[model samples]
Target: MSSSSSHPDLILTNARITSMSSSPLPSNSDAIAVTHGRVSSIGPTSAIATLAGPSTKRIDARGRSVVPGLVDAHNHGVKACLARLYACSFTFSASPQDIEAALEGFFERNSGVECVMGGRYGSEFFKTYAGQLLPTPREWLDARSRGRAVYLREESGHNGWANSRALELVGITRESVDPKGGRIGRTDAGELTGVLIEDADVQARLRWPDWTAAQYEDAVREYVKVANGFGIVGSTDADANEGILKALSEVDREGGLSLHVVAAQTTPYGHREEPLDYGLHERWRELYTSDHVDASFVKIYLDGVARDDSRTAFLLEQYLPDPRFPESHRSHAHVPAETLARDYVELDRRGFTVKTHCCGDGSVRATLDAIQAAREANPARSEIELLRHEVAHCMLVSASDIPRFRRLNAVAELSPYLWSGESCVSHRRACLGSERVERWYPVKELLDAGTELAAGSDWPAAVASVNPWPGLASLVTRTDTSDPSSAPIGLDQAVSIEDALRIFTVQGARAIKRGKDTGSIEVGKSADFVVLDRDVMEVDPRMVGATKVDVTVFEGRIVYEREGAN
Candidate 1:
């Protein structure tokens, strides 16, 4: 350890420090010194006390546990934050009647709004309404929309439903054809349905009424506060647009956001069929070149989620066909492996990191192949190791591909929020059958193979809130978190509490290639840590989710202090 400077900016005393680096639990250290927003020294309280000076501020942690601040590797920052104030949400248990009631309630309040952007509708909406393949008639949505253009995103964020008015407003008629990597939902008779899938969903989102810069700023301000409260020090905005980047830049200038944010440019949404040329690349540069946003990554969707209206996630085994609507049970890769490999290579060659959404085994395999192709095509690029490009939403991976993640130097980002539960598990069972369902996530299998495992909440897209505690709990328990009486699913895949914590902390940072600076509490690292109400390491595995963050420190400054917290 480096010798501590006599004059430190701050001193934390009487605390249990879990560096999440050298120790699996809180180390024997009782004090730490911070200088210039980075850890200077950590050891016994008496040793650290010698570094304090007249100007140094000292805080007593009251025996609370301090650990590294959590990092979310795969998050939809803008969309998740905006959903808090701007959208209506539904849960997996919601029936057709429930959806109508929720929409009606929204319309009653915003009576004169021209466009409505609602979300959180579950994947089973069409299945429960008319069966699978068939779309709910536009008039059913029009009744609640009150003639206003309405577009509601499915819970998976891979598909959406629009009212007839919205379809007309966006110029989506019978003559409209599906764009590359996108699907326009249509009936067997060739009639335009109100459902939009893949790239089409992205296009519909682009057509929504744009929010003003000020509005974006407000939403982001609240979002940062919420994230701070949860002990999140950094997040990767996996899906970012020009407006989202601009808002972040504004927030940074105003000194509102204390959390570190890395933004990625989203692939093709506004226009159809454009050549991948220098002009397109320059547009990405122009959009995210702000001081606050790291625009060095590209986000691509290789396939849509299997749940909901768009069962487009590419799978090696065919899904069980719905007895009534046999055509509904199928899968397709939104971006073919060859097409994705070409783009992945170009982006990697240009020094851009890549993050793709791959929810199914086929998509995951294809993504791995694409990354390997990129590496082989650019064998001389030594920086490939530094570019830890990841594939998010790896919910299903073929056992044969488990070892490939480490071989390809790719991170396996899992959404623990959907780890194990009746609603989510039942959905998988219905689609993939009982035998395949047993191997849902294979978290332990990946970890045991020396593959880096990263956990993400997937935020507003998930059924639960964006709190990391529940996700961590689910990772270790692999059972129904809401009900204590619920049985465990895939008990063999459950990881230890320490493993779960590492996945949420250091492993997450490694996924984003930011481990050296901020992930752990060590000398020369950023002093981003959180104090908890209780020692989570000592708690019952099931109760870990109940542990609350009492205080959050970012860059040696206390950013969030819970009411009456020590």
Candidate 2:
């Protein structure tokens, strides 16, 4: 064994380590040595064993597969943790009775919580009860709320539902005018229906009871625990506010953070009538940045979701008109093109990586155009230093705009949680028509065009959890394991497992501007990797979602160990 000073802190022996490096390790390199929170050496078990001192901790993998720790390119980590820990929690498929029961149970269990928040009921809930005279959404919620403020988010996260008490508390009423980029639902009689869309939801949420600083810190800690259990060592918080960033900074400062966090600070969205506060990003960067937290990314929402009933996604082509929206109505952008371009230019000048939410082709094109505008505005910037802005949720991009991503050095951030032939896909199919729906997630095309594709779960929105396994599986299979009988969505767009893995790992690191540090399990990189219960590379692709992490190691330390796993 080597001297204590030269010895590795930890070692893993008899393991199948998939380094995920461009240059593969030698075939005989089955063991790994970690020193001072980074990969120190990689070689055969006999050779690596020689570097371990008397005090070195060693884990016998017993031939299990180990790969780079996963990265969720985009997710609302704090919000997802809050939802998992304290919300009423029900799925979109839950019936009215089921939702009511969930609310009842939540209220019964926690008598002191001032606001009852949860949800994710589908838009079908509104369509099903649109004209009903008795038990309107407000009335239904009112009955269940016990007079407390009740707020439930829609499945898309772009809309919300509130009881009468919540509506009153938020001061949204029949007299309330729709915000420039949002709408308030009302009955034919001009009574509020408790359905808040886009900016309206934002307005209500801004006024709702928010978590305190301590709660935010707790949420961050919980988020890390859940993410580590799922083998996530890095993630981008898609919409971080001051509170979220502060919590992340505090946790990291206290040595509580186990994963790398790239926080995209929130910007104005959906016609709240507020200008983008460019100074806030600079202030946050100075105040909240830590070793594990990067507050240099910004999130901008260009448009809303593409659900059939919402029809809020800004599309180049008009949606198939429904009874509510008759004439030529392709949804409009939240910010004007000129304004978006200006914002992009300023953000680029400030060296912030912008991630714009664009669900429809129109929004996607607008975002790309803005990126081009930024590039034109900054001609002197070198390619190496140019910030790679991302088009988040590039779900319904136009064919002509596909290659522009590579030309402009932009990332197509795909949320695989929304790629399956699930209820949301069906809703999109109805709103977008057959042709567009068939070409839904153009993953292969984007990759083939040389556009860097990054994967995200978009948890607490379309997905039940932040488990990247299911999303990774969906990227290759284009099918949901939960609904095996459903048809594949964009089957031709399915990429290889190798490509999908890269999207989740290396591409994610690139998106977060940490490609050289931690994405792969190469020597000298952060010793962040997961020991899997099965070899995902060799598993049946359909069964990949079931692949579980036996243990998760972060920065040379074990952060999570599944119970009963050896």
Highest TM-score against the true fold, candidate? 2
Tens digits of per-residue lDDT for model 2 on 19-57?
889998988988999998899999999999988888899
Q: What is the TM-score of each candidate against the true structure?
A: 0.88, 0.96
1-566, model 1: which lDDT tens digit per residue? 45355688889988888788864423568888999889988888888888899888888888988888998777776677676666665665677677778788887777777888877776666766774322455666777777789887876677788888999888788899897657887778887678887778877777778877776777788878888899998887887777777788788877777787777777763222332453565576666555445677788877766653345677887787776335645576666567778877888878778888888898899899999998888777674354667878788899999999888778888887785445566777767777776777789999998888888777767545668887888888987576788677788989998899999889887766677778888889888899898887888988988778988988888899899886
Q: Kindly give the stretch of ten consecutive residues in candidate 1 with the minimal lDDT sum.
A: 269-278
Q: 549 in model 2: Cα distance from truth in Å?
A: 0.6
Candidate 2: 10-residue stretch with minimal lDDT:
127-136
TM-score, model 1 to reference: 0.88
Task: Report lDDT per candidate.
Answer: 0.77, 0.88
Superposed by TM-score, candidate 2 places the C-alpha of residue 357 at a distance from the truth, in angstroms, of: 0.1
RMSD per prediction, one decimal?
A: 4.0, 2.1
